[model samples]
Target: MPFIVTDACIQCKYTDCVSVCPMDCFVEGPNFVVIDPEGCIDCSVCVPQCPVDAIVNAAEVSPQQAEFVELNARLARAPGWRPLTQAKAPMDGHEQWAGVAGKRAHLRLTW
Candidate 1:
């Protein structure tokens, strides 16, 4: 299964995951990133690159964050989605939200 970027990624918006993805499966939004399920190779390289540990192996996704699997896939395939191939500085003030829970509600689904 592919790795799914989840709620912990909401305000953190780190591009570390994008830098190591062999398949270039990641898509970007204004304040978030999602891996395109169809494109991910399941190589698992992107997992450790995430500083917040926000990326979860799809099979291991907990019920609390299960919705994000589809969320990643949906947003990845959304119209006008763009590939984020280069790592940039994460959103400012990322430390404030790194461990914050229930951040799914704050995900910005568009660029």
Candidate 2:
């Protein structure tokens, strides 16, 4: 299964995973990064790069995070989402939001 970026990534927008991704599958949104399922090679290289432990194998996704399987794909195709290939600064106040949960509601679909 492909790796999926869960809601744990909602506001943090950490790009560490992006730099390690061989396929450059990650696409950035306003405040989050998602793996493009189509481009993801299921190599798991990006898994350890996520500080929030947001990246998970699709088969391992918990029920609460099940939506992210489709969410990542959808967001990767969103109008403003663009390839994220390098590690960069996280979103403003990322430290405060890093440990926060239930952040799916905070995801910004538009740039």
Candidate 3:
């Protein structure tokens, strides 16, 4: 039961979860970080570290967020994504987007 990074993480790109993940399984994208399903150990350590509570065990996701389960998998397997093992500041003025919805429309999939 690997965890999934959902919409709350869309534009925030918070690195708190990355810093604590024992497996270093997170992959960084333009405005998000995804958990590589194959590398994740279903550990809950990264859950609480997410400031917006965006990380949820795959089995526990709501219907609206169910897409993220597959999203994380696909993006984790995508090329050009960087591995994030250290914590960093959130995107500039991240506070404005921390909990915004409908952010998927703004997701930068190519970079």
Candidate 4:
């Protein structure tokens, strides 16, 4: 199964995971990053790289994180969500948003 980017990454938008993805499957948005299901090689290298522990295996997602399995795929292909291959600064105010729950509502679909 492909790795899924979950709500923990919503407002944080940390790109540390992007730096370790061998397939370069990450797609960037204004406040999130998703793994392209089609491009991800299931390497799991990006998992530990995510400081917020947002990346999870598709088969292992919890009930709350289930939506992200499809969300990651959909967002990766969404218009204006482009491929991200390098590590960059996290979103503004990421420190305060880190570990904050219910961040799905703040997810930005476009850049």
Candidate 1, residue 92: lDDT: 92
Question: How does model 1 fare in lDDT?
Answer: 0.88
Candidate 1 residue-wise lDDT, 12-108, digit = tens: 8999888888888898887888999999889999989998888998999999999998989889988767888888898998999998989978887
Name the regions of candidate 1 deviating beyond 4 angstroms: none
**Could you tell me the TM-score of candidate 1?**
0.94
Worst 10 residues of 1 by lDDT: 102-111
- Please report the TM-score between candidate 4 and the true structure: 0.97
Candidate 4 lDDT over 20-83, as tens digits, reads 8999999998899999999988999999998999999999999988999999989888988898
TM-score of candidate 3 relative to the true fold? 0.96
Better of 1 and 3 by lDDT: 3
The regions of model 2 sitting more than 4 angstroms off are none
Task: Output the TM-score of candidate 2.
Answer: 0.97
- Candidate 4 lDDT score at position 33: 90
Candidate 3, which segments miss by more than 4 Å at Cα?
none
Identify the leading candidate in terms of lDDT: 4
Q: What TM-score do all the candidates reach, one by one?
A: 0.94, 0.97, 0.96, 0.97
Give me the displacement of residue 46 in model 2, in angstroms: 0.7
Off by over 4 Å in 4: none
For each candidate, how many residue pairs have backbone atoms clashing (under 3 Å)?
0, 0, 0, 0
